[model samples]
Target: MDELTEFIQSNPDPRELKRALAVQMVLQEYTYFAIRDVLQVSVGFISKWKQAYEIQGVAGLALEHQGSVGYLDNEQRQAVIDWLKAKNYWNLNELQQHLEAVYDVVFASKQSYYELFSAAGISWKKTQKRNPKADPQAVERKKQEITDWLEQHRHQISSGELVVFFQDECHLLWGDLCGYVWGKTSERIEVPMSNERQKQTYYGAFNILSHKFFVQAFEQGNSEFTIAFLQALLAECPESRIALIWDGASYHRSQAVKDYLASVNQGLQESEWRITCIRFAPNDPRQNPVEDIWLQAKRFIREFYHLCQSFSTVKWLFEFVTHRQTFNFPKASMYGLFS
Candidate 1:
């Protein structure tokens, strides 16, 4: 056995010397038998340690190193976290590219990036929701308006002699009828549809109290469609006097809708088919039960309407969703802020 190799293997602190010896052995092109005898180890053991050092560098040569790949340094990884917080949005590949450009470190795989983001508690995709600009004060004002009017009619309501209906416009799109599939990491494929038809939009309404629902197809969200929805809602409901709670949307506040309500009120004075509309606070969809209905109804469609790929499929899916939502109304209406 050689003096240097024996010294490397036996010294009090031999980690650095072990790396130096492994590198020297490779550079000298020493035979496995010679290296083993000098290091006081089996030929296979010397070969294994040497190969590990060659592949993993000096850090890999230490006996206590355990030979596991270390994560990126704290500062380097913290840079990524700071970038994510600053941007507020990032895809897997985008983050990888940024990390590589700034830190010059390559992640092992896409799965590693996913693991990092998952561990840090970040959502990989956007969620559909009401606009952030929606006015909360307006919503509360409308809710108070409804509460005030309901108090005035509390006696009739308790008698079950008059029905209060909350109506709003809901648009149904052909492409919105599909169920959620397990999407691939970087690619999304759209399956072909068996039923092909022109895209169709619909205007629908549901009574907040009765759960009575009605929907009709339309070409646009104009005043005509809005009035048509109101008419359908009235037809579906047999109540003598129906009060409506709606948003302060342009169409709902338009002259056409106002005239229609006034006309209904005048004619119903004898049979009293009175209709009162309350515009909810400006941006608050939270207080409106109808918005909740739309959210849950859409979830049901997206989660299970797998075969839907066209207008007809969408219509059928809507029908199924409305049925499910209406039949489950009592349980569904139990939702609240606390819930």
Candidate 2:
């Protein structure tokens, strides 16, 4: 008897019998069309069974379709899933180490572990930075404080007398921001990298109500530079009282900045146009809308980095790009602050 007929007689499974019958017909020199006509099966079905049998032998004709056995059994897989759920982050190397340590099983290759994770419905992704010392309670309280402050100054804000701004600093590098791009299949697309290692430091603020953006490039970000930028921002908004909200950077909290703020606030109070400085909760860059603005700016710069040659050119291009772009502050505003 042929392999298919022998398998069917030995197995006695209905599904196996069906698959064996199809393979048997094919082995008997029956064309796919003839097999379909005789067995009342589709040509595709007959072809699939024939192909499976030819490639995988009688095992492929088994009634149940069990995928290749994994390194971990069902119980071990469940255990792995439970372990993953308990942890915040894990790399493939760490997972391999854990499997070797706990289960006494070692994955021969990274691909084996990757396949295991994938089969377990786990995916690799970028991890967000979270400060371990950041207090959730303090973050919530700060959010409420900001919300209350906005509510208190609703009239001044609505009348355009007082303006609120979220400010932050970012360092823009002179290298190509490497990311996925459309290219011909199986062909590598290269982005030119700059030999210049120079970077541009920028201080930017986003107007809360007007969706206005104010930015200044500096050689470095420190107390002196921050003070100068604040002075320029204040000068730009001569008509209105400004409420500047920024992160708790060391330069922002320096003695020089304090003295400058004291002098500026004293002068503004005298002139009836106040410039109030408020600090966002520590380690909470997410609370500042200006962070999103910087991210958008860097993304644009990276996408078009090949166009610029020098740091000066990059700076000019950055200013030109950012100056024309109007940020949607309301869309990027934090939950309790602008809601």
Candidate 3:
């Protein structure tokens, strides 16, 4: 039988409990019969340990204790409050010591400390602010304006006239980000490993209409890089003119970009090559289709790959996506992004 299945048959939390029992039995030099005879537990429990041993080898028998009691009584709780007042902060063990010293109270284990703090509505969570680039009102306005433009020009933008490029900066990093991997569906896990390595940001541009992709590697995306990327992108799609859609970033709207746009528009021999700008309303990344694409890319990377330990991991991830998958949900992509 499969180890997991055997473990499942042996213990409720088959993998963990079976291993725990097996290790305890080994460490204590107790046989299954001896354990059952002494502890007066069921033979099934012993069988679970034996099954866990067979499945995981010795490592399967690791013990993890779940503490029984929740918290200290009212007196000990008040003592904790007093300590908090005096010290401003205390680690679980420190608080445990203080409880024992001041209130003569003792908790069964460290997990119980969490239970106590939870009951008291105290927790340590670091709040992260969103990227401080764009303004919210401007983003909303940009989204609405873009949606209106899309609605109005729906007929004009066939497979030929409208080439929408979703462009953005992607960061590389080390190790798997916790939530992304834990949240992944099994289909995501089945993706083959990527060969690329090294930490670098790639300026990615995606054409929503054509499902074509362009990438430019950069240490970062400043005004100069953006201009160069745009020039390269212009070179790639020499046939159909692309309306440059970007956020109202300092870099994107820099004097350098304005100068480049002026030069490009001036040199446009045909009406199609004439560069028109669609600036996302300030802070509203959703107005730009590239934002969603980048987010989905990041999310996909974060969901799989235990090797996602550095920015290089993030870079490798983008390369994997670009090479492996074609764009899907173009309309929904536009809607969700521009919504």
Candidate 4:
């Protein structure tokens, strides 16, 4: 520890002094937070040099680029960029680890890492989703079918005698309190929950014609709940027949749900049925506009993670974002029925 202090005062290169100070701070029992604040370095930087000093003594704190302008040469930088380009997924920590292990280099600032990411044609952002089971052909065909079906109901919809709703279900848990936020890199962002497994199910619906969204919290998304949701939706628009569009969940098509719908439309012809359920393409959720509504509600709640400490608050936030709102998104009108 004394040797480290002497080395720090020996007027060595600024980079070497910074590294020695990190090792000395840890040995002097400085809190990681305090050390980071004073040194303007990450906790990883402190621990990395501390570990190096423990393994190789004061010599371990020496910087590879002590007199050099940059940590990596032009050729090495290209190699790092090439390695990053080879990966399908990436994160800052993974890249940092790679530089430390493969190139035996560590930058004092994150800007260097960000530069690498930028050079590799990458940036921190949300990931795109694609389902392997989704058939492009089936999706196109379903889109056409739904378009023709909506066109067929143009009269009823225009006359206000028929209401169309895109419906979906979401199971929210207590642990779903996370969302992307600007946060400290060295500090882990965590949401506290009493019971992470505590969950609630919600049946959601959106009307393309009216642009109105509706949601009901249910105990579970079983056949009974599905029927109840349908009954409630029918009651809301008492005079109009409801054309329900949703994904093909098994409970939605269960014999019990079928029997309920049959009873509701007992004497009417197929076209005149009081409640008609139309399913989106099997195993494909992207086609259902209601899926967007569900995701939006969840994202909205997650964004207010600090406020939603309890499940009840989460539920309130969920409904607050969804209920009585008009949803407008590009993919939402992909079926061209919203217009």
Candidate 5:
């Protein structure tokens, strides 16, 4: 019985795992009504799989196999493969239904269908992001512009007169902590989240020279908060000028921010401004290195989710790692090499 439970837990195929688990529960004296409530399967469904296992062992769980006596012939398998090739998408259930409907055949194992997918040159995969809004030419042009700007100001940066910072904001939701976790294969892993939407807004900056990350929590992102955060950043480094590179959020480019910049660098030229704000290309988040800083912080939350039961705990966890911590990633030096 222990071996059966272990087998059910170790099984990778979800369908087979369900069938095996249902049978295992029955043998363990779990009532049919209880199994029905737990597994969401009717009593008849449970009895069918249970009886099939009793008669044909593990092979009984499978819908069908190729050939007459539990296997399909060469021609029949080829037809199935061709049928699979005709579809742009594939899933185990769809394939099973197709085989059961067209040829009245069922493979004793899911591996048989995987073989069919392989023959059709179809491999299981997840979809990747393709950002249509990102303009390649604009991104390249901006990268070169940034490279030129950094090279031109190399002396000030080297002399510690100017500090370079990539700035961004993140909305950290309590729900973000609910991510993939390992548990017993037969059992479901549940996260205890009181309010999934409980969230905090943060302003963060990544220092290029030091690889250090700085962050501060804010009620929300707006013109007032943006300027206030900038003021806080200046207060931290009173002697050095700040070269702030960030995305073009509405607040970042608001009239209030412009007035704030103008007021600080009233008489100085653009090159000598106390705060030199550079905007990354529109809709291109890949240009900002601070993204990795936020990603790392979120990953930390996901890793230690059990510790972050409350919203206050989430904020503490974020600050504990992010405040003045140095983070060096490949994207940090995408525009210009820090070294």
Candidate 6:
């Protein structure tokens, strides 16, 4: 009886204490049936408690539900929810410190803090990196403009009078692209590499309608490289009007590049076939299909990284993949943006 009293007092969870008391009553010669009738617990539960007591005594009866009670009430939890919504970043350590400093509440363990967050319907997830300075209104306006342009040229594009190409640049390194790999517990797969991360840069354009690609290796992505690429692209489609969609990199908007565009469109009428440039909204790379092309190229390069040892081999691999026309950029993905 003394031991049962001590156990009930020491144990914090009411449910566990109730079970312990039931077991103690049975130990003192009270019938299991009577205990069940009084406590409104099943006979099987009484047996479980008795078995637990037999195995490890009072310690076994201490239910592992300390953090289940939760530390925050409705108002405190709403405060946490509001705070999380006001920011774009958070980690467990920072949150733990915040709870203590702001609410003067301390969780016994980090797990408890996580449990609280989970209970509050908050979850941790990896988010895509976005530029904070990007203007939403500007992005919306650009999207509308692009939608209208595409609609106006739908017939021309279907008949091959106008061609749209998305262009971007990417770099590939000789080092192992660290990604998920299956390994036995306590074992690691080693990827050998030289100290110098030899890399190669490439400029690429994908014709969204035709699904053809033009990729060229460049020593550096600069105004000179961009101008040369544009010249080659114009040469490829001398008769058809070319609408090159690209991001607002300094090289793309350089004075030399602007002059080159001006010269190309000097005598071309609004309806004539010539070169025109369309700039993607700032910090919006997902809208560009060429960015997807770059991602696919890099994925291929990383998957077969062992074959690419030198810069020459890397360049060859990139050219091989880009020239094969294997990458597919869905037209629906582009259409979905406007919707």
Candidate 4 has its poorest 10 consecutive residues by lDDT at: 61-70
Q: Give me the runs in candidate 1 sitting further than 4 Å from their true place.
A: 1-70, 73-87, 101-104, 127-133, 183-189, 193-198, 267-273, 283-287, 304-306, 323-339
Per-residue error at 72 for model 4, in Å?
Answer: 3.7
Model 2's alpha-carbon lDDT is 0.73
lDDT of 4 by residue, 109-209 (tens): 99999999999999888776777889899988988999899888888887788888889999988876776866798998788788988999988888878
Question: Which scores higher on lDDT, 2 or 3?
Answer: 2
| Segments of candidate 5 deviating more than 4 angstroms | 1-90, 95-131
Q: Could you give candidate 5's per-residue lDDT for residues 1-339 as a string of tens digits?
A: 565566676763555676777888899899999987787656766787789889887667654543354467899899989888898877887677566545656578889889889999999775756579999999899989988998888888877799988999999998888766667879976768889998899999988778888899898999999999999989987999999989999999999999998999999997778899998888878788887788788889888887876788988998998999877678988877665
lDDT of each: 0.60, 0.73, 0.60, 0.83, 0.82, 0.73
Question: lDDT tens digits, residues 1-339, model 3?
Answer: 244445445655333553454446644678767765664444565565566567776444544344433356787676566556566554675565444333434465667677666665677664545658757776666667877866665544554565666666665543323343343455554323343343466677766555656667877768898888888877776776777666566888899988988888786664455556776666545565555566676678666656654455566666777632456655436533421
Superposition-based RMSD of candidate 4 using all C-alpha atoms, in angstroms: 8.0
| Candidates ranked, most accurate by TM-score first | 4, 5, 2, 1, 6, 3
Which candidate comes out best when scored by TM-score?
Answer: 4
**Candidate 5 global TM-score:** 0.71
The runs of at least 3 residues in candidate 4 whose Cα sits more than 4 Å from the true structure, single-residue gaps closed, are 1-66, 73-79, 91-105, 125-130, 183-190, 337-339
Q: Report the C-alpha displacement of residue 25, candidate 5, in angstroms.
A: 35
lDDT of 1 by residue, 34-113 (tens): 76557543454456556766677654455453343335788877767766767766677566545543453456677778
| Model 6, position 8: C-alpha lDDT score | 81
